[model samples]
Target: MIVVGAGIAGVACAGELVRAGVPVEVRERGRVPGGRLASRRFDGRPTDTGAAYLTADDPDFTEVVEGWRAAGLVREWTDTFLAYGADGHREVSGPRRWAAPRGLRSLVEELARDLPVTVDRPVTSVRPGPVVDGRSCAAVALCVPGPQAAPLLDPALTAATRAVGEQRWSPSLATVLRFPSRRWADFRGAFVNDHPVLALVCDDGDRRGDDAPVLVAHTTPEFAAGHLAQPGAAGPPVEQAVRDLLGLPEPAELVHVHRWTYAKPTAGGVGTYHLDDEGIGLAGDAFGKPRVQSAWRSGRDLGRALAERLLTVGG
Candidate 1:
């Protein structure tokens, strides 16, 4: 099995296939796996710029999450999640909101390390041509975001692959702030409801690591949309919004803005899609209603579907 893109969905699919005794090779465009579930460093502290926490709604994901928790790859951060309510910021206590003791994204990176992953090798295109010059790939999985995966497919079957258009994703900017000391004493996390530019503010040191103080503020889709058209995925609006939201007195020692051109799901897709004709399949957050659990379940389903198809073919 050849899985394109090493995000959680891709990793989950490959991991399951490997467990089924199927040899899998993961091709990732980035230097490391994890995709949107990515982490970065600041003054030696690792902060997740992508997904903050995951809430498992599906039983399959819950079971997988349990294993992850046992292996120390994941942990229950909290039962309550802070969101904007009629009051201002209301703490809705229900589902188990999980985070990494280190960084949420690190879990993916750790699990994918030993696997056969080809980094920095972006798949330019895929056709019906031979897998090994004539064999036709036993199967190919395209796990990249929709906009990115569309053009890389063969023109003749582009419509079938046009399943890409069935989905839509948004962009966002993450501005990391390292304060001299702790600022907000309310809770570990906060959802800024009324902010024009900022959407979320999370204290990195609260659950992940012990440090002086660090805040990772995510920009609203409206704000990120305007800035995403720029060349690189970084800029000033994101930084300024972080300071404005927290009312920062001055600049911190280290400041970095990471703009995700493809962030949230604008329009949710089906549970998941599989293209058997060309031996290609697709999965991601956009594969369903935007959520970490949705993405995980999508990968799970994709893996099962692929394995079933492979079994029908032969051994």
Candidate 2:
């Protein structure tokens, strides 16, 4: 089996298949795993620029989070976030969000530690035999955003093609701003509603538990759409928006922006995963509410389903 993605979803699927006594390989186009759980180092410190944080509610996913917590890879962030809208800024309580001291990417890396994962190797096509780039496999799982997966799938594979076609995605930009010191009121995270440029912002220092005077902001889909070509160009505006929202006195000393063309699914899928007679599987956050847990569950369910089918056929 081949999983053509190294994100949490892909790694989770591979883990299940391996437990089922199925040999599997993971291929990733990027230099590292993590996908949207992306984190980047700036000034010798890891900052979460992709997903602000994650929440766990499912019993299975809660167990996974507990493992991450015991391994010192994750920490309970906060249940409350400040929401800024037309009226004013107010604290909103929600589920307990989790964060990683090392960065969310580390969690994905930990899961992939024992898997046969190949980085920087992009799979070009998934053909009729469920072949990956001309190599026939027992099965192939495309654990990626539907927009990205759509291009790699051959039109001859109707089941997978139709699945990808029915999905819709949106884009966003994550900006990291480093200031001389923390000048704004302390807040873990903030939701900027009705904002022209910014959508969400997090105090990276607080989130990382490092006290580093750094802030990470996500741009609205509408704003991100215009700056998709050059995400770096969005840094100034994103930084400005953050400063304005938080009423910071000084400008950021440094700013970095990362682009997410398909940041999230616009709507949820009908099922947790998709598997067909073609022996191709599709799993990702798109399969349910777009979240870290959703991606994990989607891949896990798909892996179990595939293992049953393969084992039965072999028997």
Candidate 3:
């Protein structure tokens, strides 16, 4: 079995296959795993620039989160977020949001600990017979964003790939700012409403429980789209918006901008996964809700189904 992409979905699927005694290899284009659950080091501190937090209401996912919590890989970040608009800011409470001290990426890395993951080996194409990058495989799982997976599918699987491609994915520009001091308002994060440039802002210090005076902000999809060609160009507006939102006089000491072409799925996924008779499968957050837990569930379920089919054939 071959799994493309090492995001949560891909790692979860590979983990299940390993547990089922199936030989599997994971290929990731990025230098590291964790596509959206990305974290980077800024000024020697880990900052979550991609996913804000993990929220789970499903029993099975909650149990998995609990296990991660027990292992000290995850912790409850917060249940409330401040919604900012023209009127004012209001606190909205929801399910507990989970965070990892080391970084969100560590969760996927932990799950992929025992799996055989080949980083920097991007599969250029997936043909019938479940061939990946011209290599024949019994089964192939494309656990990446729909837009990304779409181009890789062979023309023969147009129906499957087209359905995956048609799914709308919104882009995002994440700006990370490190201030000289924590002079902002006393809030973990804020959802900016009616903002022309910014959509969300998170205090990296608060989210990681480190009080590091770092802020991570995400631009609106519209704004991101306009600046996709030059992601760094989107930084100034976002920085200005953050400064204005927090009533700050000056910019941060350091500013870094990152671009995500397929940040989130605008619409719900087709289903848990798309497994055609050709033995080609698609699984990811795009196949369900745009959530980390959903990606894991989609991949796990697909991995189980593939394992059953393979086992039956072997028997």
Candidate 4:
């Protein structure tokens, strides 16, 4: 068995397969295996640039969160987020969001530590017979966004191809801003509604629990769509928007931006995963809500199905 994409979902799937006694390997196109749980180092500090935070509600996923918490990789950040929109600025309560001290990427890495992952090797295609780039495997799992997975899947694989085609994705730009001091309110995160440029903003210092004057802002998909070609150019407007939103007294000392072409799925799929007789499986956040826990569960379910099928065939 082979899993493509080493994000939390992909890694989770691989872990299940390994436990089931299936020989599995993961191939990731990125240099590292974080997928959407992306984190980058800025000024020797790890900053989250992809997922803003995570929440655990499902019982099974909550258990996984407990393991992370026990390992000191995650901590409860906040349950309330300030909403800014036409109505007015107000605080809204939601699930308890979780953050990582070493950055969200660390959580993905921890999950993948025991898996056999090959990084920086992009698979060109997944064809009929469930072959991955001409290498035949017992089964193939494409754990990526619909837009990304669609390109790699051969048209002959109708089920996988059609499923990916039905998915709608949106893009976003995550900008990191470093300031001289923390001048914003005590809020940890905010959701900006009806904003032209900003969608969400997180206090990285607060999220990291380090008290460093840094902010991470996610741009609205509409605004991000215009700057996908050159994400760096979007940094200025993103930083400016954050500064204005928080009424910062000074300009940021540094600005950096990362683009996510398929940052999120417009809607969730009817099933947690898709597995066809062709031995091709599909899993990701698209299988459920666009959240880290959803992706993990999607992959988990897919892995179990694949393991059962393979074991039954062997028997």
In candidate 3, residue 96 scores what lDDT?
A: 86
| Model 2 agreement with the true structure over 160-223: per-residue lDDT tens digits | 8999898899999999999999898788999999999988999999999988999999999999
Compared with the true structure, what per-residue lDDT tens digits does model 1 show for residues 99-195? 7876777877765766788889787777764142133568877777888887777766654466777778888888777767775554667677877
Q: What's the C-alpha lDDT at position 28 in model 2?
A: 99
How far does residue 109 in candidate 4 sit from its true spot (Å)? Answer: 0.8
Over the stretch 182-241, how does candidate 4's per-residue lDDT look in tens digits?
A: 888799999999999999999999999998999999999999999999999998888888
For model 2 the TM-score comes to: 0.99
The weakest ten consecutive residues by lDDT in model 4 span 267-276
Question: Least lDDT summed over 10 consecutive residues: which range in candidate 1?
Answer: 128-137
Give the CA lDDT, 0 to 100, for residue 113 in model 1. Answer: 66
Query: Candidates ranked by TM-score, best first?
Result: 2, 4, 3, 1
lDDT of each residue in 1-315, candidate 3, tens digit only: 999999999999998899999999999999999889999997678888889899999898899899899999998988899999989989999878888888899999988888999998999988888788778888988898888988888889866676686688999999999989999877888899989999899988888888888999999999999999999887777888899889998788888999999999986457788787888888888777788999999999889988988878877
How many pairs collide in each candidate, listed in order? Answer: 1, 0, 0, 0
Q: What is residue 140's positional error in candidate 3, in angstroms?
A: 0.3
**C-alpha lDDT of all candidate models, in order:** 0.74, 0.92, 0.88, 0.93
